[model samples]
Target: MVDKPVPDATRRSEKSRRAIHDAALALVAEVGYPKTTVEAIAARAGVGKQTIYRWWPSKADVLLEAFLDLGAQTARELGQEPYVIPDTGDLAVDLKAVLRATVDELLDPRFEAPARALAAEGLVNEPLGREFVAKLLEPQLRLYVDRLRSAQDAGDVRPDVDPRIALELFVSPLAQRWLQHTGPISYEYTDTLVDYALHGLAPR
Candidate 1:
């Protein structure tokens, strides 16, 4: 069967939805999570609050979808596959490539301010924090988990290693630097992280 053409009204709605997502991201970056409301996002987007409500159940819902959209856009711009980590048959190379991309994302101005705001709120608000981690963070982390598991099958990683916990050796460090400003982030830094995580630091 031939695909039905998209209606003009639906196209208009999609455009409005993109506006809402962009407005929500910008507002959250400026105002923090506690103060960024549905009304505020609608106003910033020049859409009616009812328009936002018609599409999303709550402010958090809008924000979540906004972030998901942001990641997809970034992925496309970078020419990388969205929502998947590359294997390349080398675990260390794969890890470093992903980490470098992450460093780029963390440094991106559009993503940085809003992500920092949400992360700060997530720290103080347990439920919100957990929800964000579950939805936004965990899925990304799972890509690493899958990569590590594949490494194990290929004998690149020790069979005894737990993919979930093992992957954290590099990920958490980058997250700490990004979230806490503990240190500067760079391709070299993340590359070092991947090396140390995969190979013991104590002269291994």
Candidate 2:
């Protein structure tokens, strides 16, 4: 079969995939998502228009993968698994530890720029917003679900509580702070979140 014509296109496609992801993230960060386009990404990435279309159906898809890749890279650098929350027996300690690390990740420039861009877009783009929540955000949230379930089983958390919703008490507060400039995030803040969530805000 003439050595399959060297498969040069496959190698070129892989390079173009990386380039497109980089370009999409940069464009979103620089111009915001409303003004970003496949044409702009293609030009910035130094690839043909068809190259991006070949892989991702839309800019939202490209951005979603870019954000996921950034998270994975950061996790690898920190020597932690990207999609699992640790259960160290002490529920408060474990939750606080993970949330503290998340505070660091959210504050990092590399993660912040692109994430803010995408989040701003998602606020107005209904379909894209739901997709981001479903695919990228929800999967990560499920990690907390798993951790909380373990805590419930261990009698650290109330078994009657729904782990999914329970996890959100702490998770959503931190997310809101980071997303909306609502407040400062720190180990102390996250620690407080865990404490309040576990013991209840009332006079427990």
Q: How accurate is candidate 1 locally (lDDT)?
A: 0.92
In candidate 2, position 105 carries an lDDT of: 96
Backbone clashes in candidate 1 total 0
Which has the greatest lDDT? 1
Query: What digit string (tens of lDDT, one per residue) describes model 2 on residues 39-157?
Result: 99999999888878878898888888888887888899988875578777888888888898899999998888888998988898889989999999888888888998888889888
Question: For model 1, how does the per-residue alpha-carbon lDDT over 70-91 read when each residue is reduced to its tens digit?
Answer: 9999999999876778879988
lDDT of 2: 0.87
Query: How does each model score on TM-score?
Result: 0.96, 0.91
Task: Quote the lDDT for 149 in model 2.
Answer: 88
- For model 1, the stretches where C-alpha displacement exceeds 4 angstroms are 1-5
Please state the error at residue 74 of candidate 1 in Å: 0.5
Enumerate residue pairs that collide in model 2.
none
* Candidate 2, poorest ten consecutive residues by summed lDDT: 1-10
